[model samples]
Target: MGFRKGISILTISAAFALALSGCTSDKPAPSASTAPTASSSPSDSGEGGTDAKLEALGLDSNLKFKETRKITVEVYDRGNDGGTKPEDNFYTTYIKEGMLRDHNVEVTFVPVPRWTETEVINNYLAANQAPDVSLTYSYPTIQTYANMGGILDLAPILAENKELFPDMFEYLTETNIYWDQDPATGTLWALEGRLNVLNRINTFVRQDWLQKLNIEPPTNLQEFESMLRAFKDNASTLLGADADKMIPFSTSFDVGWRADHLTTSFMPNDLTDKDIYVNGFDDRLFLMPNYKEGIRTLNKWYNEGLVWKDFPLYPAGDTTEDNLMKLGHVGAFMHNWDYPYRNGDDSIHASLQRLVGPDAAYVAVESFPNDAGVYKKFLSGPIDRKVFFPATNKEPIASLLYVNWISKFENRVFLQFGEEGVTHEKLPDGSLKTIATTGEKIMNSPANIDYTITSNGINLGDPDLTVKSIANGYAGVDSKLIEIAHKITTNDGRIGKNANVGQIKAEDGQGQALKEKRDTILNKAVVAAVDKFDEIYDSGMKDYLNSGGQAIIDERKAAWEKTYGTETMLK
Candidate 1:
């Protein structure tokens, strides 16, 4: 924040004036360092000192090590699994012992509560104590950090070390790849940790509840509503007689309320066949006409007692199931397709199975018909959450190597499956037969998934690894549930028409500010009467534009036209 880029006070003043005068450069402003040299592969570089060793391995030049160094990183401790304790967690220990320690780089994973992740991260960033590698799903936060010089510029580092990260580079730069860029210069600055499977975005329903209520799974909107009512009516008998506990369509206002698939019928944006996830770069929400309709549906469900009553009061990271499902009260949930089976003995499936019997059942509602009878909804490519190194990091090189370690195939296999024979026995057929308590499905977890560092990102390279994760989940006696979930996700999932091509302009820096303004207005609208939706939206949009929303949208529209031309992208 104190000008590490070395621009003098006078130059800063000139830039500030230009910024205030509403002039933005078409390109990114220059940074302190020059572009870095590239390496074809790890073997292409010289060897000697720690710096030379990194170069020899095709790592970033900035990643230099001398003797033993301890590097601090942040990880999300969701408190869902006791074995996932951050300080001594299996994944953290794997990084420390399996990878970082050999290089004399000790890793201390700082635990940030998963529920308060964003707020906690912002606080650490403000104090300059944030992790060397950090992640967030919000692009606005990344832009704000880059503008304040809070994050390290990794474009040159990533470019130079491409050989060390072939899968990552290809996944990001390939035809349909997705990655973030510097708003000012449009250079790559951050890296994304991607999801291995696209099957996470479908609907999960309690099939046992349906059977008990003698109702078939809902096919369309009206039947879906009818199912919710049936769940509500039969709640006491099937889900224990707790009047306040029974929730038909469980969801949290903080996160789950607007899950793309849940509101696919609303068609949140006219920009595409699917929903345009604000990207946090475009800050264009109230402008989307059908967006309010999505909120209106939630409000209608809330007033009718279909959704969780205290949902609005829940904290950001607390999803609907966090409040109800694990307690065996939720009848239906629209979340990760594998929600029921996660968390082992403490998992949703385990708890629900305890109440019913060993033959607990869940079925995937493959594709829900929207009002127009379409199954299209927003689903991102491999990666959705992205990670970056902040400028305040003590050792950038160690961080990069740490990333490289996780990105490697063998290391990731260890983390994903645990110490092979100990946690898993490698089958001769090349598929994994998970060990009782230590495998991914039971006890092990991929490291730093919250920070966009994972085995998941690199798992795409091998067919063995590709099928292993699903095998871990599907290894159960009944593969029917997992198969149906996979079919629904791969078959009906949607992506943005131009997901990868959009540029982040300089004006996008105002997104965070406008987002805060919009959130205040949005809260009022979501709880408002259906008829009052437009009035609340107008009030919010008015404040947003007055406070710089118009500038952001204007620049974004210009950038859109410049990229695709007006003939393709309309106003």
Candidate 2:
């Protein structure tokens, strides 16, 4: 409790923490990591004198090594979906050149499958072939490696080289930088990436369908169910020839992710901090109290033929669910706040307008309310991704320097919004407007997030600027609609408490495997017969507990009690 923490472990309650700032195709083979080499002194920096010039521009050349320091960082490989190799695009090239010109660092990127990132990172760690700098969504993976001494303890390096990472420190701040600190030892293995935009999930319904049926948007669970029934009963009226194809509610194999708002709505609002930390093993709250009833509700809908029956059949990346939604066969569903407006011309909204009718559109709705009668949203904390250095990283300073350079305002802005008149242009009001581009300059990821490892979302260095730029980023979507959806995402949002307890050993090596088991449980329970819903769900949950769920719960509960005994630990 006495150690440096960004936010207090206790007193983190159901308050809206809103800061309105705010992959691809190639399947390129990963580059091999080489041995670490020594760096040259500032005086030995080559006759090109780039370091001196960089020094002249306010950079501390003394902080940089005179010789080139080579380090590899992990980048997600989405299999060329953005029309360029994920590992070697214009953005990656820019990063390599920028790091070299500014920090005398030669950077290479190692690509891992985006969807299967945990498995790939695990394999790399096990084989001792991980990139010098690694990034992952799963903090447990880093902890597991750290437990086995495969991760570098960044505390000393960061403390010893404070001047080298001022931008990183400023951007991430204490809350994110020390998010994963070991409570007992005061050691840190990873730094949390900052999420500028904090909006969570929302339920979306077809406004056109609602108008056609003359049914007002539902405001609660019972009304929501009734609305779904209306969609099913009037499928023939809405779809005519495609009535049979109409899925009143559509979701995928990852039910917990797609339908999270529904389950969280069932979670009791009075849950204690200890209760949340203990049961919050997976991202989904499937193991939370009353969550089974939420699954049972879905099962009831599934039996009545209101839910997507074939959802469980499709796996990740199949695109079956997306294709259904875009074709306008899906009446309503729950997903990210801006799911409909992404990807510009290729977005779901665009596809729906082209395939269905111009009048058809998925609009955000507020239908689910918790036991306390408030719409409770368990939003992600300020942290986004976990950035760490592998034990094999000999150039820890260089890696930190590279991350620091990326976190700087000027560098990250260019990465997010490319050259003017190309990827983006400045509006008359001084806000950035992204434009579609082709050829070598095309951005491989939205906002060039893949390359900006230390930061997430649009941060134009000011709160108002970030909010305006984000609202303007959606090309065809109405800015009003985006603003409304943004409000909905942060409505009654509750951030989970980051208890300063030491690593939960059970969670160290079990994130991915337990996630698979958890998904199987939710997927099976949703499609089971109504009479067998409880039985299937209970049995699957029992199996999940036996397969490491119970251990994580026990560890978290014990850790909480050990730190704060007999107290709810709320603000």
Q: Which candidate tops TM-score?
A: 2
Candidate 2's residue-wise lDDT over 389-423, tens digit each? 87777666678888898899899999999898888
The clash count for each model shown is 3, 14
TM for candidate 2 is 0.88
lDDT of 1 by residue, 454-568 (tens): 4343253676655654555433425667667767765645643433344445444564565556556656666777778788878777887777766665666566556555454
Query: Cα lDDT of all candidates, in order?
Result: 0.57, 0.78
For candidate 2, give the lDDT of residue 479. Answer: 85
Which segments of model 2 are wrong by more than 4 Å?
1-62, 80-82
For each candidate, give its TM-score against the true structure.
Answer: 0.77, 0.88
Say which candidate scores most in lDDT. Answer: 2
